[model samples]
Target: MNAVAVIEAAVPASPREEWLNRGKNLGAERRDVDWRLADWLSEGKAAGHLDQAGFDFLADNLGIGPAKLKLIHKAAAIPTHLRDTSLTVEHHAHVAELPVQEQIELLTEAKRQHWSDDDLRKQTITRKVETGRAAMLSQEEWDDLSRMQFLHVWNRASVAAREDIAELVSQSHMRCIDA
Candidate 1:
């Protein structure tokens, strides 16, 4: 076939292919908006432009939940250069407390692999363990030692403290079940 014929015979991009690329572009835009909002939030709070009442008003006006606002606030710690436009705000939040170099490395790998937020979170935890910043309990250790550790703490508590802890543990158990 002639070059023109060969070119004409090639298939156009499929809808799925187009949508996948669009998703990446959309994610990048979303990341930029989130980063800008986070910066504004951090600056406003620090500059006395936003207090609790002001935050309440803003949250009400913007329809942003306290939890999401907290996450955005936490995300403000991440530097702009380390941000990957192809990742979500949550991805940045997960690595916000990490060192700048770690953030760059993690975000770069995440963008290249198209990792989900949960996948990124797991990877971050693993990185923390590797760097000795955190520890992970093995399944066997959790099964065998968790109850003993709880009992050890529980036994030394005052009656009032025990009651408080009981309430907290009850709430924690409910949260775990809901999760």
Candidate 2:
């Protein structure tokens, strides 16, 4: 018997069979079109065929905003080998903004922790904040700031006094950086 005939014969004439057949048909044509479009955009950008104006025009025509196009470009830049295909596009978009090492670290952590996109986004924000705060403090200042006494003082300080102290520390750090 022919393959199509055999397959049809195997599926008994029932509602379940009809639903299964419909699902199979739909699944057969499913494609990752968004990823493909992002890759195409990245290729065009890399080749100098697509600049900000071109990207904006194309995005406008497609009904997606410039921010979405930028996200797609970022997602496309991530090497295929490094991407977690099982993750959602939003997850990939979040990790794509991170540095390569941090991306790997977070992806690994996400898998280990079974984190949702929201969880990963929160972690990313925390990481950025911690890095920024660390950048603002010298090693000695960091050590001092971590002390219990300093914490107690900061906890007890008035709002105005806290602001003045922060301003002074920021100026001192700026001077250190300039020198």
Candidate 3:
């Protein structure tokens, strides 16, 4: 449920972190969301994967802060054609054909690549299912996602000493010493 079931509560960005909120300065400009992120979400919807609640969670937690996120809550609640299971995407396919696992896989890969959902859907519609075959995701996408090299490993490590940290990032904003 990336964009279908949820609307995140965005907090406003402060001076130092303002760059990530899409827009924070010059007024009016801030209301618009990042188009690419929105697109990824829309694709998630078309694929029958994105729900409103999940999308809200991601936007609130990762993409924007609380105050600003909350501001867009109402606008994000609007329903779209993709939300109905009875309706076919592009006007075809049974409701059963839209597999949840496939949708989830598609969303995950798109997130990994930072792709808008619409981009993925267009690719699917124009290429994957258009070649006179049964409806299915592109084989290239499936193979790419399934490959071992595509795997990403994440683990946390511990560290000590503030000075050590500053030394490590001496050239960064977190630098301890005022060089």
Candidate 4:
């Protein structure tokens, strides 16, 4: 009897390291959201790119009472950085002048693991994906979750994707993740 053969490819280090290091030095959220939520939001607010209505729309989806919404609106608007899955706590730390090799480590690992943009987006939107280092969450976890739920309304995924969640199956168990 002959045994079946399989061919697998190996991933390199240079490109992955480069990607994890790239996309930095682009934010300036040190004043507002950078300290609280994200660097992009701080810059957005400071630059006058973030509008109150956009925040109002985001706040409306929060399901908080009208009174609380007013308070949030008065305090700070939703940071545009939250919109990107790649944005993480390290981004804020970078703005505040903090060292975060863990951030790099986690990102490198995620890249090596080949987590797709959707996978990273799922983690960000679900508040499950955080910077490798722990300090403070960028935004209200509920807010992120709620925003994801709201966006799902107009967004349509493939049948396979719909099953990706509802199927209650683990790819690792089927030689996906662990492989």
Candidate 5:
């Protein structure tokens, strides 16, 4: 046997080394596993297999930067059942802040529509606006108002539209206070 083969035979990979190898493989593939890796890392930490030092080691060795680490940590909030294998990590991250039911609904719709990350983001914003509007106005009042495209796309609204929204929100707040 060669010297490298003999050395490999003499020393086996430790648990941490094995875990790191698995993580590296998953990271390199870049599919269906952002959450999986996050879940494993978190489980390892919880099970006493990984401490802060170990986490730092993996982060350094695996090239997991702060942004990716944050995304992984956030994506972990999504339950395994809710995760779609076809979707990317960014897709899951977009809906991670939403409630579990909303998460499932949006993810289902996203998968059905083959939504990109931006599409999912716009949908999430629209959903939030609808929910917020529901809280601030009765169904009748909401229906009585003129339909404006700007209302559906707050992020792309013009300056005047923003002013109008601010005014409307303030008026709604005043009405609520008066009630």
Candidate 6:
């Protein structure tokens, strides 16, 4: 007599777990060492032991660009407890470049949304662009830039003359204020 055997399948892993597994499959060991190096660099920087030459040497020896080393140093500024190890060093580096409060908010959102490193980088870039634009442009300057861009496009379109485009732009501004 043959008896049938019942086997239970394993539960599926969460996104974080899946990501961790993927990283484990990759060169996680090397990454761990990199993280440690970042920490060491941070400590040295804090103690004023690491100078420009030291940074340059590390960057050269590591075979990474100076910009990447700078990012690693910025990432190391994040406190150990607050750091989200689930994210890659690059993600931390991007977030660390932001203000402390913004860094926390972005990291929290990234973890909650299970964002990829690229997603985090994109969001960081967008925020930086917005911040820079706001700082560099007054409302009048921004409006001028917008109008210039609109005029450039309208000039190429035979359907709308300069006067018509100007009228439409004014109407759009009025509509925005009304809303």
Q: How well is each residue in 1-179 modelled by candidate 3, as lDDT tens digits?
A: 46667779999768668664434343223222332344455566678765657666767668664333332332232234233222112111111134445444544455466554445544444343445433364464455434422232111223445445446666676545444
Off by over 4 Å in 6: 1-28, 112-114, 128-179
Better of 1 and 2 by lDDT: 1
RMSD of 4: 19.0
RMSD of 6: 10.5
How many clashes (backbone atoms < 3 Å, residues ≥3 apart in a chain or on different chains) does model 5 have?
Answer: 0
For model 2, how does the per-residue alpha-carbon lDDT over 61-145 read when each residue is reduced to its tens digit? 9887887777677678778888776554456766675678988898889878989876775566556556674454435434544
Query: In model 3, where is the ten-residue run with the lowest total lDDT?
Result: 87-96
Tens digits of lDDT, candidate 4, 39-106: 44455667886676745664577544443433333223323432223443332232221123433443
Q: State which candidate has the highest lDDT.
A: 1
Per residue, candidate 5 scores C-alpha lDDT tens digits across 26-54 of 76577655767878877876788776577
What's the residue-level lDDT of 77 in candidate 3? 29
Per-residue CA lDDT of candidate 6, range 1-179, in tens? 99999999999999999998888867667556657878988889889978888888877887877777776786787878878776767778777757888888898899899998667866775676677734544454456556665667877877656667567768896665332
Instruction: Per model, state how many residue pairs clash.
Output: 0, 0, 27, 0, 0, 0
- What global local distance difference test value does model 6 have? 0.74
Tell me how candidate 5 scores on lDDT.
0.71
Off by over 4 Å in 2: 1-31, 111-116, 132-179
Select the stronger candidate by TM-score from 1 and 2: 1
User: On a 0 to 100 scale, what is the lDDT of residue 172 in model 4?
Assistant: 47
**Tens-digit lDDT track of model 1 for 60-140:** 888988757767777888777766666777888878768888888998899889898767766776686668876443453
| Candidate ordering by lDDT (highest first) | 1, 6, 5, 2, 4, 3
lDDT of each: 0.76, 0.71, 0.42, 0.44, 0.71, 0.74
